[model samples]
Target: MNNAIGNSMYVVIAGAGHVGAHIAEALLEQGHSVAVIESDMKRFENIEAMDVLAIHGNAASPKNLADAGINSANMLVAVTGSDETNIIACVIGKSKGCKTIARLRSPDYLREGVGTGNLDVFGMDLVVSPDVVTANHISRSLLLPSLVESGELSEGQSLIIELRLSEGNPTLRRMLGSIQLPPGAIICSVSRNGQLLLPERVGPLELGDRIILVLDSRMLVANVETAFGVTKGGGTAVGGRLETGIDKIVIVGATKTGIQVAKKLENEKAMIVMDTNTERCQHARDVLEKAIVIHGDATDSALFIDEGLGDASVLVATTKNTDFNMLSCLLAKKRGVTRTMAIVDEPELKLLFEQIGVDMAVSPRMMTVDFILQNILGKQISSTQTTLHGSGITVLEVLVKDTLWMVGKEFGNIKFPRGAFVGSVIRGGKAIKPTRFDTIMPGDRIIMMAPQDSLHKVEKLFSYHSGTWRFR
Candidate 1:
């Protein structure tokens, strides 16, 4: 049976933890029918308050899957703490003819699916690892220190970045059309005083205006920074040069997240990992070749000096302990570390950490939720949609089809919905900065940004033809 809400799917989530609850809430907001199964009584009770079929039982049990309405579920997401339980739930859901996604933490299980291009491993249509996802986020931030937020588009060939205009920015007083941006970069939208302004409507940029930019991934981060007039010296700059110039990198905690971060960066920089547990340090040493592992209290101020954290270019705290991670980053910053990042357990603390001097604060749960939501909705909507942090704007990457109404039409002729801005068009494997005169062609991948409310209108323009909806 189809949901009364248009284009809505029935989704069964196995787990009531942070990731599962967030997923349920997001789906509900999108008008999808949802159900959640949780073994923990407290967690189950908490999720039951939502408008979902809350089944309190082990998600791995077949009876529990049936109780959660797996028979009619369009999707089943298993995000419990136990990897095996998640996998089993996915298998059960898959048998019931539902698309399944599992969140696995073990590297062994992740390697079997993620990056292999075969997400169907263990009967799961998609597999996501929060620790690995969070590690990748931290690695990208460390590698490209200037980006406030970033995501890949056009299959990783293009990148979308958000940067807040700061004082002394060269482009601060320039009209949106007059700024000298990099060759492949296009300013998608500007967030000014809580309003999202399209490029055509934006005036001269002011300090504190957050600008979203879509560009070729190969463009230098330094150039982007220079275009915005971000200086190199003071801690005021949000990002650093693309070349990184990072000589030494220190990671606190030898946990899975920390180890993954070190693993991604060890080959490029002088890597050092510290943890309070000697056993964990030994484990890190055994697995990581280029990293130097040390057992020490990260919160201890003496350890920072003793390990020469003062000379380090970037310090990342990845422990499970939020207090420890915050303390470690703060201490490292005090000792003169150029950049400090922390893995935040609570999403609310991300801003607090940044305000208190942490250069970046990443939440694994949020990252996992984003990944899952993108994958699930991307299939149903025929487009990739991601929301820019704190901005009511969402970036959508849509494939131009021959049946689209705008096909062969100049962008200037198309009456796009208000608050919608087409950023770039990818055709013939190259990203093009589209002008009003550019012609929309079939097979072209159009990247655009629009307000949440305007998304449906934007989609209708592209997906409707001859008074009928033809979604591709």
Candidate 2:
């Protein structure tokens, strides 16, 4: 039933929603041969024409699948608006002898699929639930400073980690070889300033050097805290790790996302939520259950002092008002909070968080974009995050695929876009801030951060790769 023709594997996407388009864009940009088969004719016309092959058709029907050439297609991702359409598309793709992936939005499928009798009946490779992925990312990112990135692989046998050297980081100006990586950790790449860099044997790591590493599952949180210069000791940085944690956290807003932030924590950290609305603050209190909710202004210094806001380990400002969130986080930082988080939705005000001294600025919109890109795109883009200031940097957690042309090269040999830096690498379960000695491997997950304008240059890291990445 699957009769598709292409020089190599072709990916067929069966939806044109926000997430589907994002996936298509990424695949097209990363040079993947993707045929988007959207049922909506009007929406199909709106799909961006930047080098992607767009075929308007319905994959839900068997006839349509045959017409769309599903026989030779490698992978089929069903992400249409209707769950029935997605499942039907997957079933047809499987019948055509192609690997199948379906976006299962219902939590029922997520909970019952594995043990629930019949998911294996179809040729399902991976089933993604957006809420689960989004919640997981949000919880993890909320726990650490913006400088460190972490990922899980192989059920704990291996990991991918990224570290960004900030202006005030204690590891600044140190020789790459001098710092000892954790046991079972390997460094992958170093992003210095905004360039993907390969440091010399004697090169010293200055502030703002970004490092990506892979580590063994046994690594503890205390070790991570120590490695990243956190005041607290021994706990890992994944889900459920921070709840048993004994640090204090203050969230300066009572929005829905703020509630999500609190729900993610499973630790004993004292949480105080502050908001201007009496009812909203009360709702935050009731919803958090374990947190102390204060109905007061976040910008008020006296209130901050009285509530011990400055003494918290982390301060998260998730107010809808970007300006207020940034300012509140700055206030907390000045009061000596160790870590801070702020949610800013505006792309234009990206610089405000940095200028205002917030430790990290998060945008749900951008994160949602990355989440949508995960399933529809063929490229192995694990996750994407952007860091502010220091020349408009962006970090992409991309799986190294065989189609990449720049594979098996040392960091120093890779040509980065001007103003881009290749910081450090995570290899074999350890962090290696490479001194121009490390090499890229097949299974390696590379974390590269570069200037916002230099993303095109960063893509050159895979100049010869076939899979497309719709980079933002």
Candidate 3:
């Protein structure tokens, strides 16, 4: 979660696209009040279905925001796909004493400094770029790929992975009693096409069953591959766009994915190409950088044991050979390294990594498509996956205006949405997990969580703003 988020703020979100809707859902899950202003009829109808106070109107107009209960709101987030639209909504919302944040894609907005010439000029608080985020995800995965992607759904001491079913599945039709899950790990849920997966002690698995499981980070990938049906050595053969580095990253691969990761991360990154091909590495170095290049079979585990990876905090592996990255990560994990990451291109490998344990894995093509589709008119995103990969959640810091509507209301009485988790409360800067008997008074900022579906209802539950929707 971004540091800017807290609990307890009346929020007005403009646009319900991938980022916008994702933010709205996050805010909703926190139990904070949110009113979404959408200009598109279809988008409005869709958001309305989520049970939020969705209004169909022009977000570019101050009246539209006011209608969504903005004047009395504590914050407003503009996530319209168009940078200009987001800027306009945030500018107006900020002027009304509502803290505002906008989403922009221009790197120029994030220049080394902050001021009138940048995002600050528009009264925006945050600037997010799907491309940059996607690049980072890809880079992190390329570094390790062994552990699947990170942060799917993290509960304290636990993580979830979305694994696809593959051929020769050893655990097929076997109950949890039969399968040997790595120590310190347990199967959490088995996600099928569209269902809420619950732990079934006697559940039977079938072919093509996509399992979502969790395991200890210390488990070995090789063991996981053996338990599941994977290529003899987890072959490489990655395929993606190719480019050079903008940051000084030393990737050890010459395959398509290796090239793609390089291309996406290109710009100001002085990348050091490492491979065993003296001629090819030299050629790659010639086109990318003329720095010291290492040429040797990276599959040799002794090399990593010999030369310590540089001070670089990030490592990427897109080598055509999966075993190379996998074994490399196992060695890295043994060194007591905390932030080791990996990228497994195989869709089926998603769950295998979880059964073992890897930091993060990302599907370039799926993420790209999801990111692009998330940019729509008014609303930011639509699906549940996008919500997690997108903003997913928000923290609201709100001052209770000491009104009768909230003064005596108990949290349980509010019955916050299913997904919302109330984290804490702030009384004069000291934070505390609000007690059940906690009575809200004036000048109190309570943090909350609500699903996107509950955003509208949350707004009405605590909204003192005049623009707040009054339902029967």
Report the Cα lDDT for residue 206, model 2: 70
RMSD of each: 5.1, 7.1, 13.4
Cand. 1 TM to true fold: 0.79
Residue-wise C-alpha lDDT for candidate 1, range 15-134, written one tens digit per residue:
999999998987776667899999999999999899999999999999989988998887889999998999899888888888788888887776722421235768987778888777
lDDT of 3 by residue, 371-407 (tens): 3222211111122122221223322223455443656
Best by lDDT: 1
TM-score of each: 0.79, 0.64, 0.44
The C-alpha lDDT values of all candidates are 0.76, 0.62, 0.50
| Of 1 and 3, the candidate ranking higher by TM-score | 1
- Residue pairs in clash, model 1: 145-239, 146-239
Q: Which RMSD does model 2 reach against the true structure?
A: 7.1
Instruction: Rank the candidate models, highest lDDT first.
Output: 1, 2, 3
